[model samples]
Target: MKNKIFFLSCFILLSLTSFSQSISSSPYSLYGVGSLYDSDFGAIPSMGSSGIALTPSNFINNLNPASLGFMPLNHFMLDVGGKAIATTYQSSSKSEKRNNFQFSHFAFAFPVTKKSGFSVSLRPYSSASYKISDLKLPILDSNESYYLTAGGTGGLNNFDFSYGYRFTDKFTLGISTALLFGNVDDNRTFTILNSITNIHKKTDYNGFRATIGSQYKIDSTFTIGTTIKLPTQIKSSKVQTVETVADEVLSVIESNTPSDVDDYYMPLEIGVGISKKFKKALTVNFDYQKSLWNDTRQSDLYGDFVNQDRFALGFAYLDEKSNFRKYWDRIQYFAGANFDTGYLEIDGKRVNNASVSVGINLPIENSLSSLNISYSYGQKGRISEGLIKENYHKLSLNLSLDGIWFVKRKIE
Candidate 1:
């Protein structure tokens, strides 16, 4: 019980992110999912990571109800992972670089009945962290200069409850709804004093995300599965309050006033994915998904970084001798590619990026996770020159602590 509780504590702490500043680009958020989450939760192993996602149909696709139909376990599963980022950037006048370790994700899934299951996942759904410091005294009468730095975090973080049910021997259905919460903190320091201001804006957005899929076994040599997800709706409150150091020291500003900002919605996607296997161990999955970004643009709480198309190819392998897996295939190892097209808005213009990425699986002991590391790289083009673009790269690791509690049947 202690271990289970300890594991859950990690989830609560993880939701409270942002001790530093980072800028990650996402086809959705202009930069990645803000620092709130891994832009491609294993979607891209390297730079060119794009699209619906190449989730291995069995244990990892719990978020998608159709994917839950693939679970062979009557038990439970828990997953955890994180990543360290080393990023550098350049334009014309100056170049900058920074490094930091960010908490990536944590998840838990379990069964509810003989043919039904449920899951709870805590993850950052979106984020905002920015830091800029410069003194205006440059050549300033060459006399004096004072520098100030400030960092803030905001956006959607996800807490969800899901259920999956197998209606027939070959059919399964799933639905998951999520609640989003936003937290922001502003820390500032200058030549005179240091202070921290808290901006807490709460939003209650209920979204319905579900999938319907089925599987068919054609003898032992062939098996196939397919799934589809409906569009989602996210609604939330748009009230913001900013308290300054003077407000804290002098009690000057209105600390509890709510802003009259309007509520907004996040874009939804229509997805279809399929999987095929031969002899169990050797399997392949291909997913095609189109996000209906335009559907929510005017009502979208998010910016123009929304992507309309995302594609992914994923595969896995195992060292035949591994026994952790229930299927004939022992150690599940996989590799795949991706391509995405999306618009990025900066100075009132939409800059489109065409990016690609690929990756492989490395399982530690043939479970839902291992000491697995995936890498990817991709380039965005169109405006500047031939490769006038964004080069993307990522490296991430996954870990899990899993076991079963067996109640031995006593001989009567």
Candidate 2:
């Protein structure tokens, strides 16, 4: 237990200090806080990211904070994960490919009392990383063609703390507070072909959020859960610069000069889910989620923001007894599918996404901990109406440590 505690502390420090690169390249990320992070902290992501209604007997359930109350007494859980993404973008004229590796999330959960628990987590809520450049016709009356370039980097990070209380044997309630903060750097540049004129612009962002969740057990095998994330506004500031370089001399019009900008609004979200566990081996779950972007009455400069909805279904298989004779029996298998009606609307068309996922949880030798690995393939957007299409493959890996802590030991 002491060793596990030390390891958890080390991992938390590492996550805070490590400079992991961005894992996304979708142009759609330009709409919101970048592409929203879909995966949670543990094996739940492997099971189609649907575990709101399921209890956390073996892993962390950051989806529904209310499930935290279901943790066993004296049991502490820690999860650390990362992901890799490979994406191909296609248009009517050309295609390009991009790949990235990034840290996913880290979390810790433990029981506070016999009927209560709490958890703390650090994860990226969204990411924006894209670069697009093209040649444009001469601006205004200028005969020289200029290069048009637009790109953005940076995203929001969520530091969340939650507490869950069991109201009854069958019901639990929880609340979460999240501190959201980040810098969004949007860069748009125009450069003349034969002149030393370059213009650039950028924008930065900061925010806060909260959520409530509940879970009800219908029976030994069935459970239902719900969650709501409150909306908030992100304060933003902008800056514009113009630079000229000629004959080994450089001149700048503005450098890091702050400009006035309107606040960005994040949409409210609601989700409901159900889960059924059969005979302690097979578990199935389904979820429906919606983001109320329309209510925020906000729109991006590049696209219109509309309501977003998602549906997912998944299942997992676990062996209660590791049948030492058959290693396969000790491995857990998971698979699921999801469909999303995206929030970004362009040219009277809505961007959507569809994906399928599969994963396995393998028990570590001589321990209750497990190593989880999951893979997903998905497509986003359409190549019609001058819009680009994206196909992506993602791989995730996590280590979940479940162990007893703060208990008296019998020393020989």
Candidate 3:
């Protein structure tokens, strides 16, 4: 039975992987590598993406690797998730709507010993899919303006391996290593007066990064955790073609020219979180994270990089002593909220985001397997001159399944 389940899961995972490309369509994705993705696993999406101090005894926790230290003995776990998003883009002149389906993440974990665990996961790191048409911009140092049309596709993917060890009953430490790789293709058309120019480029990137985390239990009901993400540079190379049309005559300036480009720098990040339990029925989690984007000294053509701050809070409830005959009584309910002071600043205005989510976990049969469903409503950016605002509704579904290993069955 276990072998059948594993093979079935592998088949589904491959199917989803083929359709996971182009998960984002935000105009904001035109900047940097693209819009960063949130591929939180299991119930983490329902918890406002907050779970730094949580243990992975019930579900895998991607925010902090230390959570794996508490994995139940002799248990193997697998988690897969996906999302559907509907968004409305609003500007001063018009509004547009788009919908997308995203393959969120896939992971599996197992215990190495009584006090240690390890996991491996694969997920998208960013999305570079966007489209813009006839955007007018003033030419620098001139009274003239130009019309610009741009489109891009492709993004980065993250493959990570993590390990956690419990040194004592009250403390755990963990480490993670990630490989980031992908490519982006962009095409742009510029119209200045009667002259037209076109540029098409494809850039490839690859890099490695590391993270360290620690968790400590203050008491039976309280826990605290911290994590540090080291900065790294992504190596980049590009092939570009540039052409121009003058007096209705087309001329090629560069044809498939390959060259080295500036390497992209990822900023250092730090995070802290706390988890508290009230009796056995309710749990609360709060987390704060900071990214030093300004310190990286990275500048975009249309925006400035600034320090970023994020906060998340979540609540979960379940009835531990409810009647066993009532299925609803065994279900877990969750609610959460998140706020982010974005790292990109355009026209002296910061692009920010805020969101709230609610969800439930439904158990399957009598095993440690369940389905997680969540809904989120959020807003990003703001309506202003040359700015677009996004209002989105997202639905997430995650399946978590666990199987017992290395245990003898009494009857077989």
Candidate 4:
């Protein structure tokens, strides 16, 4: 049964890779590097992405690398996941709906020693795919307005490497290094009276960032964790083309000109989490994170940066009595909620998000291997003049497989 499950998971992983490039689209993606992505792995998605203090004895934990230090000896773990989203975008005047499917992440981990572990992963960091047509806005210092049309695509990818070391039976420390790289393509058209102008640009970006984390076990059934992400800058360069047309005449101001642009700055972030168990069958997890974007002193053409806060809470339940004869006894159930005070401020208003989710982990065999499925509904932004709101439903699927190594069969 284990071998069959492993091969089936491998097939699904390969099939999903082809859709990895598909990205969710949003008008908010027009800002910064695109909409920031959530690539949580395993049952973490079902738990509202609140697993920073979880032990990694059965599955990989992407939130806090320090959790890796607790990996069971001689065990290798693999995780892969994807998401499907259906969104409704609304303005005071109209509403539109869209659907998207995209791959989330791929990761693997293994113990390096009895007291240490290592892992690596690849995932998208952001998505900048959006389209806006015939948006009317007043010209600066003038009552007259211009009509604008714009579209963009592309974003950044993250490659991460992490290591954890256990200092004692109850304490662990870890570090993670991430490489961010990608390019964005944008085209905009503006019509003011009789004259029309068009601009096309492609910007490339690259950067590196680091995070440090620690976890401490308060007792047999309680743990706490903390993580700090350092600030960094992403360098950028762009190639652009500009043209104008008026009175049946066309003019090219610049053609494929290359130049350096302002670098994007990432702010320092801090997070804390706790996990507690009750009666050996129920578990609760909670997390809070803060991003000091205001300190970055960054402003966009359409928005401003502000400090951000995120909160997540989750609960899980399972039967404590093991019954090999009953498969349902091994299943686990989870539910969670999350809220974010976003970092983007437009017209003195902050965009925010709130969501609730529920899911289950279905055991594949007698091991820790399982298939995770989750559903969530969320709302982002608010309905107001000059701003849009988004209501979305998301479905997440993940496969986690566990294997043992370095042990020989006695009967063989």
Top-scoring candidate (TM-score): 4
The order by descending TM-score is 4, 3, 2, 1
Q: Give the better candidate number (1 or 3) by lDDT.
A: 3
What is the C-alpha lDDT profile of model 3 across 72-151, one tens digit per residue?
99999999987888999999999999988789998999998899899999999999989999999889999999999999
TM-score of 3: 0.95
lDDT tens digits, residues 1-412, model 2? 3366446544643553364665566777777678887647668777778887988677888888899888899999888887777899998788999887777788899999999999999988888887777635355686656666778888888899999999899999999998878877776666665446565656667777889999999998899999999998888877877787766478897887777877888789999999998888889999999999999888875578899999989899885656755656778899988889988898788899998999988766555677778999999999974478999998887878888898898995
Name the regions of candidate 1 deviating beyond 4 angstroms: 1-36, 39-58, 132-151, 184-257, 278-281, 299-307, 319-332, 343-369, 379-392, 406-412
For candidate 1, what is the lDDT?
0.48
* Pairs that clash in candidate 2: none
lDDT of 4 by residue, 243-273 (tens): 9999979999999999768899999999999
Model 2 spans with C-alpha error above 4 angstroms: 1-19, 135-147, 190-199, 242-254, 319-327
lDDT per model vs. reference: 0.48, 0.81, 0.89, 0.90
lDDT of 4: 0.90
- Lowest lDDT block of 10, candidate 2: 8-17
lDDT score, candidate 3: 0.89
